[model samples]
Target: MSRRKVGLWYRLAAALTRPPMMMLFRRDWRGRHHIPATGGFMVVVNHNSSLDPVAYGHYQYSTGRVPRFLAKSSLFTNGAVGAMLRRTGQIPVPRGTKDVRDALKAAVSAVNGGEGVVFYPEGTLTRDPDLWPMAGRTGAARVALRTRCPVIPVAQWGAHRVLPPYQKKPRIFPRTTHQVLAGPALDLSSYYGRAVTPALLGEVTDVFMGAITDLLAEIRGEPAPAIRQRTGREHPHGLPSVSGRS
Candidate 1:
């Protein structure tokens, strides 16, 4: 398939999001060159505040790359909104589906189609009180390995200050500085031929989150905590059973 470019939906989003980003926040975006000019890859980001999506999405878009995200199936099940999401090439994964493989498959397909996909290894806003990246889910590592794509770790901060997770409204006036930094693609060569299991996946997943955390540490000018907060599972109610199995 010919490489897909940004469509009307992305442009519309840019129109709406870029202005507020510019007017309400100062930017410290860096290392955008890490975003490939072409081809398939994964950009795994840390989830902090609710606005991190916009902040991180803008981080990628500003690099002149349109991102294909894996959103909830419900978002694509609506009428007009669903139509637009499909038109925009956003993949939908039915939450709580018995076959989680389907979701990973769709994401891998997106990358193989020459489109970049963004994964939040934590799968939700960090519940960590201080906003450090919690222990990540295996989804990010699974997709990257299955697709054999470069997994670029992206770290972003200051969005939490602008709009704290679950905060009903974002503070607008003071102009918070949203900092986004992109790190080099992770080196997974050591495990290329290893058996695909939860243990191996967990190892790579930790590395993925660590890369983001290291960059975040740089952005914040502090040392990243030595150990990842063992916040079970990516979801609040439970950690997906796939994490500990071999």
Candidate 2:
């Protein structure tokens, strides 16, 4: 359970990205102690804005456990940005493809190798009009169950005020607060040693999503809605789901 050595590329990336993040948003990060101090783990997060990754990364990186994020495959095709991502050991997820075996294998291998892998299991940003967390895909659950690593449920809000989902412009003059809370690692002992099936994956994934939602509710100081939103489906408010290739 020794800490993974920080590579030069990660240091460089952090050096470049941290200052900008600090300038744009004030942070209210709690539960830092909940993050495994010395072990491989999975950090499951709810995605709202594009900037949350930077916010979450800064929070996690500040704790001295560098996380390898599962980012969009398109981001890996860019020139300089892509080079930095690859050099820093970020995983590229081929969104919407049935052929994610490679990415899944890489994630399992990373956790087994004692690296922290961050997963936005909802795949992409929540399509919920109320901005609550939506039902997620099973990628994180698969990795967690496969490695049985500590799965840290983290909830973050307030980034959307800086930059709304799918919007190109950021309202940066007035700095926003990035509120993130990391809950204790989820206990999946009952699921361990069980057969891995779609039903099992979905069940485990629900637990991950529920934990995240509860944390978010605490941050918002409001009760979460009774019904969770699912991507690609309409809900009671006549809100149509917006799909993303996360």
- List ranges where model 2 is wrong by over 4 Å: 233-246
RMSD (CA, angstroms), candidate 1: 5.8
- The true-versus-predicted C-alpha distance at residue 57 of model 1, in Å, is 1.1
lDDT of each: 0.79, 0.88
Q: For residues 109-223, could you state the per-residue lDDT of candidate 2 as single tens digits?
A: 9898888999999888777877889999999999999999999999998788887886769889778789999999999999999999999999999999999999999998888
In candidate 1, list every pair of residues with a backbone clash: 233-239
Q: For each predicted model, how many residue pairs clash, with residues at least 3 apart or on different chains?
A: 1, 0
